[model samples]
Target: MPHNTIRTARCAALVGPYLAGKTTLLESLLFAAGAISRKGSVRDGNSVGDSAPEAKARKMSTEVNAASFEYLGERWSILDCPGSVELACESQNALMAADLAVVVAEAAPDKAVLLAPLFKFLDDRRIPHILFINKIDTLGDQSVRAVVSAYQEVSTRKLVLRAVPMREKGVVTGLVDLVSERAWRFNPHKPSNPVSLPDALKTDESEARQALLESIADFDDALLEKLLEDMAPDSDAVYDSLAQELANDQIVPVFFGSAENDNGVRRLLKALRHEGPEVAVTAARVDAPAQGAVAVQIVKTQIGSHAGKLSLARVWRGEVADGMILGGERVSGVFRLFGHEQTKIPTATAGDLVALGRLDKAATGDRLTDANGGKGNLGAPADWPERPAPVYGLALHAENRNDDVKLSSAIQKLTEEDPSLVLEQASDTGELVLWGQGDIHLRIAMDRLRGKFNVAVKGQAPQIPYQESIRKGTSHHARYKRQTGGHGQFADIQIDIRPLPRGSGIQFEDAVVGGSVPRQYIGSVEAGIRDAAARGPLGFPVVDFAVTLTGGQFHPVDSSDMAFKTAARQAIAEALPACEPVLLEPLLTVTIAVPSAFTPKIQRLVSGRRGQLMGFDARPGWPGWDEVKASLPQADMQDLIVELRSLSLGVGTYVWEFDRLQEAVGRAADRAVEIRREVLAAQ
Candidate 1:
């Protein structure tokens, strides 16, 4: 009982897998706390969370939604986070600022695997968390044992069941508090009414209560003594011990509820009020000053039409006020966020999550402190979540060519807002490519470009940097003669083209004798040869070949660098067809990561994509996981991440780099060439 856990405000995050009902639970909690008079349904697009238009259209949470409420004279900020693996960075960033995280899970054994990665993150950071088994109303004789057992396998810490579901005729109707030994009946959309314990569950309840006591006793020697001597522990003592243990992240208390029915939300809130850790403990963990200074961390940023830039931040310590100069930027406004609505708060103090208006330079993941004497932040940035590597990519272009500059500016703003959004100007293809976590992640980014910035853009799979080179060698001679109005252009060059080994790239050699081609024009000839090799007869960049300027004659007065360059270009272009041009496709050495259970499937997936297996080993630092290495064709990597997630319960990912170029043959080469020709013709 460190200060009995009573702070003016506390922040909690709702995190779970997609469609696990976190958004629904947010509405229920707001209702239970009396923050709203009526609850709104997500299906109707009226819920407080998921208020963004992108979320509404997709019927899923595309970002983090922060809402504040008052319960029993205490203030709380609940961050409802997106559950898709594509947006896990949002949840990870918000979690670093939270005092406790409520892991909302479905009450089904099959869906337990989805919690593994999330649980590991929380435990590794020592963040206090609780398990609320949601949607219990869908249960028919809900096997609490089956659900708990399934979750236990993934959780490294212990799980203590705080309540047992009360069932009648194979249908769960209510819950019996294991700590208080009191039974309550669900009254849908209202407060649960107290009821006497049923006789049939008395024995089952006794065993469950005993198990709960033992789990808590493991962390308390005194409690262990009491349990060892067969002496019953007092309910009040049990509550205090459970609260302390939860604060330390030693255990996760389990509760059963149906947010759709508001069945156990009140009881869950009660547990939070008593068990959530105080602000001081968390402020120390984040290295925020204990007192006398303002320290805030920006978790999310947004662009508003009228209000301008909005920075959603958690006040770590001290008071933040409007017009105050912090980190060299004046705060335009300080307000609390409630979905689309903002309440103007004069000054936000410690433990408050607020939206600061128009802090121009303060970006997400930035720790801004007002006390550091012009240093800006708290000496060093706090522990921030890293932006995940981009797994999916598309070449983007403005639909209207006139909007090209505007589109680039809009994309810059979007990338600044979300670091996970990556923009790359492809050097080989000259395409503006946007990379993100998945197809839907980039889709939302593009939607914002259109909806918010009024720029319409089209996306397509980025083209592979395919190259072509000569498989055989040929020698040719050519001359350029152009009569201008005054001086005539005349140049002659004899060159030899030869195939180099793989990875040799394009090379230029000078073997001219006795200044036949002047030193000044020799470089121009090589440049011209490279330009001609850019697009061979195969319509791709050429590589892995060498060209030698054997002998060339240039007139001192008539031949300029341009004349020699033209002659060199003509010689290579004519010789390329005779030298037998071949198409060379790029290859990538991709390392696929997944749980060992899915190793076989990963192997099959690689083989199906014409990938050559390079063996697999246990992923470093990750137990029960394997990293499979393979060399795959660049064309086949477009949708590989999508299929990896599908096969591995949305947790698999891969990283790849250009390995080498191999000659393309058969239908693959013919199809690619045909497509390239059609594209060139259309242009």
Candidate 2:
């Protein structure tokens, strides 16, 4: 898109930890912009952004919701994202679509630490942002400074004061504008009331002004020179430096207010209108391919009401109209997404965020472009963060037998919506497994499965897949003789079994003497040994073992392949018990990344789970967060994340990979072996 032609619809994403009032802030902004008549509280369940039934029940956003408001004649697209760490991916996706972010933090210093991961994410992405010190009505003046200092100590960027708390007898009434050097007071109970500048704030206002000037001077050489000469810098110079420093993400402009009470909301909106999107840096564009037509990038995807799939796209350089050809396919229609509602737009231009309806094949990272003679691969930038792998799994089965086909179809659609979800059929276990990031992520997927597609499924933790292997060498002999009136079948076989190295799998070798067993009979003996390996002495699939057909005898006319095979299988079964078999449980290489404060707790938890800590390393740019590497049994891994998240205050993150199956030969392993024996006997 041409720099001048592209409408600058810079977006600001409201994001924080759970219950931080992100949706409420959006509601406040919508009312402040006159987009709505009255503000709707989340408790009332009438908020525009949180219309989904799940969101209404939880009273929190579960996905990204956007609304556009015209402030100072400039279009600002505000995205309200979910705050729950379970839905952090939604916030990250919103951040990718936005040019800047507004991190809302509680006034309490302890609670303010929740913004650490988000701040690091924005810093790494180079997204400029402002800090809204919310819930000031609950904190005293001294507490507010303590919270500010706590944030400054943790944040790498300077936290410059853009607005100071307006006080009356030590009670915060409103905020004093530092740049404007004016006192503004608003009714804390009623946010829409016009704020009045109070004279009682004069002394504090002067100190705030000087603090703001000195902070700006630290960045601007000219302002520093003016400060040295004891001459105040021009207001334009101060604002210019503020804008430049904020745009470069060198400074995080801080404003104090209470979102719930609506105090300082109007001023915050005014500040955003003047300094937010208007000064946002444009996203870097990818150089267009020579022969391909204009391309549009799809940043988000939504399943709309009564609508199939909505591909939320931003046109980089193209005009899309109804029935227009794109990527050799016809553009069905372009529409704007208003919360959960969709409005059909006749045409969508470059830089406009629109929902392309009925794009079932389209995905979150897909690119739509005019095809050059029906041949070209125009796609969005592929350098974005890779989706997390699914480490947790659940076994799912449909309740109604008739809904089996429907269940399969629903699972496919659900997987499409969330690329992180992985579906697989266990070949050995013959069970359907749904894998996801964590327990909550998988539960949400299951909820969508039932709610969106009406596919009722029973979910449970999957059974641990265990293997049986031998520990010592043993030999046994078997003979099969059957009499059937005229002809008789007879065969004799001897087999030797031995344990192989871990993960070596099963191997069969024929070491029969020249005339002891026929060539055809030797093949049958090997097949029988392979079949016996399927269900070892413990009834679980055998692994990491080898078998050899040492010697066997076959009657020329009476002994057939079936006779030799049956005899060999019986011999191997007899040899397995004497071979001293053991059970092998799957081990997982679990890597947990958590705040340093919780390291000791995590180590203790790992120890309790019988895990071995391999090492610990620091996570780059994230102070007080350590990456802990450990190897844990797969069975112990269940619900381990729940404890970790609780310990780390939801900032904990982890990824696990399958290591190898090792012998589990203690009391627990014996119990598993006993259970397998009972199950096999019953079968």
What do the candidate models score in CA lDDT, each in turn?
A: 0.88, 0.76
Query: 587 in model 2: Cα distance from truth in Å?
Result: 2.0
Candidate 1: residue 297 lDDT (0-100): 82
Instruction: Locate the minimum summed-lDDT window of 10 residues in model 1.
Output: 374-383
**What TM-score does prediction 2 earn?**
0.91
Best by lDDT: 1
| Shift of residue 64 alpha carbon in model 2, Å | 1.4
Q: Which ten residues in a row have the lowest lDDT in candidate 2?
A: 279-288
- Candidate 1, overall lDDT? 0.88
What are the per-residue Cα lDDT tens digits for candidate 2 across 1-683? 22234445556789888887788888887777777788888899888898877788777786788786555555667889888877776677667666568888878788756888888878876777888887787776574557788888667788887876766677777676777666666675465343665666677677778877887778788998998999977777787888778777888888878778777777778766566533214344233333444666666776643567777776655567887766656667888666777778787765566777776666776666777753334655554546766657888989897888888888888776666778998886777999876787777777787788888898887767889888799888899999898768889987777889997988888888877888878888888878878888887988888888888788877899898888978887788888888888999999998878888888898999979999899976687788999999987887887888888887787888889998897887988788778867896
- Models 1 onward score TM values of 0.97, 0.91
- The residue pairs that clash in candidate 1, if any, are none
Q: What are the per-residue Cα lDDT tens digits for candidate 1 across 271-377?
A: 98898887787887677643337888888888854458988988887888998877668888998889889988788888889998888887888888776553465
What is the lDDT for 521 in model 1? 93
